[model samples]
Target: MSTVIKIENLGKQYRLGQIGTGTVSHDLNRWWAKIRGKEDPFLKIGEANDRTTKGNSEYVWALKNIDFTVNQGDVLGIIGRNGAGKSTLLKILSRTTLPTIGSLKVKGRIASLLEVGTGFHPELSGRDNIFQNGALLGMTKKEITKKFDEIVDFSGVERYIDTPVKRYSSGMYVRLAFAVAAHLESEILIVDEVLAVGDAEFQKKCLGKMKDVSNKEGRTVLFVSHNMGAIKNLCTKGLLLENGETKIYGEIDDVINQYFKKSDAAEGYFTSAKLDKSEVVFIRSIRLSNQTGRATEIFNTGDDLIVDLELESDEDISKPNIAVGIKSKNGFITIGNTMLDGNQMPDLKKGLNKLSITFRSIPLLPQEYFLGIGMRSYDCKTFLMTTKEIGYFNISTRMVDLGITKPMAEEIAMDSVSPFIPYEWDFGNGNIQSFNILNNVIK
Candidate 1:
């Protein structure tokens, strides 16, 4: 397949605090330089886009020396942290903004859904907006008419097709916007995180449509999202940007793995003071330990996860709601626990406190998992402290526990078995009956 889009040395620069020259004289100097076929003086002093650092220059590069190519019918996923220049790159690709440097080559009509209601005129009716977007994508009236019904039906807004979009809710606007962009017959499609505003069902529909567009219609796509699952599912290739610079570009799985390695959980330990902030109650430290009681980031199936929590408080907190949430490396919240729920929660005294939470024979399949801890008032109205993805541990596949009667590889999950819970089964009335299947394992 041919390259549908190519960017070489692509760069975009912006002023830090002021817009369009601090003074008229400077603006004239820039115009004179532009007219004389000379480089703009401001370009020489632009700083790199490292958000963590303070720089002296008034200009910063939103994107610098970005080079990549997207093949025809390829779906490329772009990912990065906030202010990492993801939106800026998309804006440049969508022609909504001009890059201060470098060249961008395009091979087809590009339809972009960068933001909610990006191409729509709010005063116009949904029906009119659909036709307008189609027209902008170079579709003739006849061609747009042919797809009009499909677009309206897909948007699930047929009842309000003639209603002015100004009154549409954000979700409705996203649905209509996505439907038009997907059906407008554009050869290339670009979608930003704006799709996240849509409901789960609508997002599923949009993903399916993008798949159809790429596979059935042979169109190219550029998808930008923070949802690693979505990116892994929809994209065949990936591009990772940090500080407005391309860090990795290749197959999606490798790219996602690289992403996991860069995440906070990958550190296996979160020690920063940012984890807790409440004076009523605060966590002093949180860490993970394996069965041997030694701090370990790697775990085998059927190993105990010992979570040690040390906390402090300025005032006595009675019956504080304490919990720990375990999330998979893929960002799935696998299991969460509270102070045994509906039971007598121990009163937390002022000053230092210590506790250990243990998950016997961790049942999660071979993968990485992170921790999210929280504490709140007994009434659940005030949060003392809460943290997410504070630390992570890895689970490697291991043989079944030494005494297990039967074990299946596929049975592994957040809860494969409960050794701590006691239960009784009775064959009553020729039917099996259970007593307290979820009876307390930890007491």
Candidate 2:
């Protein structure tokens, strides 16, 4: 396969402080120098950030000496934490942003959906905007007309296709924007975390369309998303970036492992909490344990989870209320039953207390998870304290199930009422017995 995208020692630098503050004079000087065939006026700069302090530096490199090649028909996944230069790379590929250093080469026309309203004309009607975006992507008016109805239907905005996009809901805007980008023809597709919006059905449809576009049409796609699930499903290869540098490139799993190694906290917790009212109240630590009753980073499908909340309150009130929450990696908070209510007989006094909350069955499928906890007064109306991202845990399980975690099962003794078996008995006497499989099986 030919190299569709080649990035050679690519580097992008951003000056510290507000942009445009001191840029007008520099811009004018550079423009005149370029017109007069002279070197850039402000090319000399000291080495980047002092690494001593975490404070912002006068200059920073968003990408540094990056080199990679994407082959034709390759669906490459770019994974990185926020500000890791993933978007910078995508923007360079799409020509939205120019690299400050090095060079990049592309072999095909690219359509980028880097942001929610990117390439959209808010003043124009949705229908007109479709043609505008298509034309910008090198599609002729006739080609857009040929695919107009399909785009409208796919976007589910046929009724409002003539309305100005400014009036459309965020969902509606995303739907139409994504529809145009995904459906219209292009040699290369560049998407960056735009699928994080829209409903589940729309996300699924977009994923399906992306798969079809690459597999059937053999288009080269460069995708950047924080959603590991989507990345795993849509991309055949993964590229991990950290602090504007490529940490791992090639296989998806290898990239993901390297990404975790870099991003995970030192304590292996999703979050750390330091109570503000330290004089009166404080929370030292918290964690979720797996079935083996050990502090583990991985879990199985049917493991019983124990959430341990270790607290050190200077002086616990007469009645203290507390609740623990488990948030999915996608930010869905799964609220579990709490013991802080007056209905529970337990009394939480002063000093350090080790509270263990247990759940027989965990509903969440195998994935990274986050934890949140809260404390309140017994009145159930007064808020005492709350902690977010208390910790992070990994529930590592195979692809056995999709949505729900549990599957019902039953066992029977050899002599117990004949094991239920659903069957139709044909008797010559003209009488027959018929029963449901579950009913008979449990008989």
Candidate 3:
């Protein structure tokens, strides 16, 4: 295998709240600066890509000085928060956009399925779009004809093959687009979160196809998605981008662990402006604590765990129930307790209230999970306030003997149903039982 894709000093700059030189003076200034062998004057005025802040500069770098490589037959998973320049980098790689600085070298035909109906014309039928996409990949008519059936069959959209893509639902669009990209003999495949539009069954099929392309066909893939499970599954390497900068690179598992280690608040306190709130009832505070009642974001599997919450209501509340739970990386509830889930709960007093739920032993397998909290009326129909994911925590099942601390996301069980460790066993020189199957007899 060779270095098929290499990028050096790649960067992308954008002007916030404006497109293409908001004013003629600014554009002239930039050009003048460049002609004088100087940096763009606007480049000196941009703020970091932090989404929460009110940016001070009109210019921002969606991506800056990113340098990495993708070798032949490598599946590199790129992950980060929204606005981390994931889409921008892919656009540059796919030739849909040009980087403001640096260069990219590509050695193979690239097939990119970026967004819903990304490459397809809304007026073109699915069948026609197949050929269109192939052409975009530099494929000839004969070659596309050869792979046409496989693409259509894989997409499972033959019934609507002749229908204009504009009529296709989001799911159907992604299925057809992905199918075309996967089977059209392209050497490099770049996929975004388009598969998120498909059903679970289809998502599974796409993942399998990606694996086959990389493992069997010896192709390269650049994938970006928030689905960490999928990232861990099909990728041998990972690249984590933070605020438009390269944070970590290399082995998939280590990169993911770095993400968690850098992301979650280990002190067990999480406060976000994105939490769901309303005037009726809203979250005042959310935290996680261990056995000692000290704030912590990391806990051992099968050990005591605690969740504390402070909520507020503007008006007198009646029959309000509180709920707390841990959500997996996939956004599913691993386990939780609710006041409305057959538990008698007290009414929340106006202004402020505090509650804590304690678990004798955390049953979760070794993994990292999100903290979820909600406040609602007892009837469950009245939505007072809720925060789907306000904080993050990790369950450490460090095997002292093996010195294992971090387990990959996919290796952990879905539900924390069983305690994975901390059990006792003893074997004395007492009589032992043995069985032999060769002679169909037990001895």
The most accurate candidate by TM-score is 3
Screening candidate 3 with a backbone cut-off below 3 angstroms (N, C-alpha, C), the clashing residue pairs are none
Tell how far residue 397 is off in model 1, in angstroms: 12
Per-residue lDDT of model 2, residues 1-443, tens digit only: 89988989998877777887768887898899999999765554423333334654467777887999998889999998777888888878888789988899888788886367767889999999999887877789999999999999999999999999989888888888888888768889988778778886787778888888889999988888876666766788999887788888898866765665524454333333454743344566665566677765555556666666666666656656665666664454454433422233144557776665654456445456667777766666666565455666654443434343221111001001212112232222344333233453554
**Local error of candidate 3 at residue 183 (angstroms):** 1.5
Which portions of model 1 show Cα errors greater than 4 Å?
A: 20-23, 29-39, 263-266, 274-324, 327-370, 374-389, 392-443
Clashes of 2: 6
Task: Please report, in order, the local distance difference test score of every candidate based on alpha carbons.
Answer: 0.74, 0.69, 0.74
Give the total clashing residue pairs for model 3: 0
lDDT score at residue 94, model 1, on the 0-100 scale: 90
Q: Put down candidate 1 lDDT per residue, 1-443, tens digits, no spaces.
A: 89989999999998888665566877888999999999898889887799889999888999999999999999999988788899999999999899988999999799887378777899999999988877776789899899899989999999989999999999999998888788877889998877668776787788888889999999999999876656766799999888888889999876766655444342334463544444466666776777787776767767777777777778787877766767763454434334344433467778877776666666666455678777778887778786555666755443344334232332233223323322122112233222232664456
Q: List TM-scores for all candidates, in order.
A: 0.72, 0.73, 0.74
Candidate 3 per-residue lDDT over residues 1-443, each given as its tens digit: 79999999999888888665558888888899989999877777766677777887877889988999889999999988788889999999999899988899999888887477667899999989999877877789999899999989999999999999899998998888788788868789998888768887898789889999999999999999876667877799999988888888899877766666545445777654434444477666677778888887777766666666666677777766655666775564433435423454566677877666665566665556877776677777777875456777776553432354444334334333443211111112232222122234355
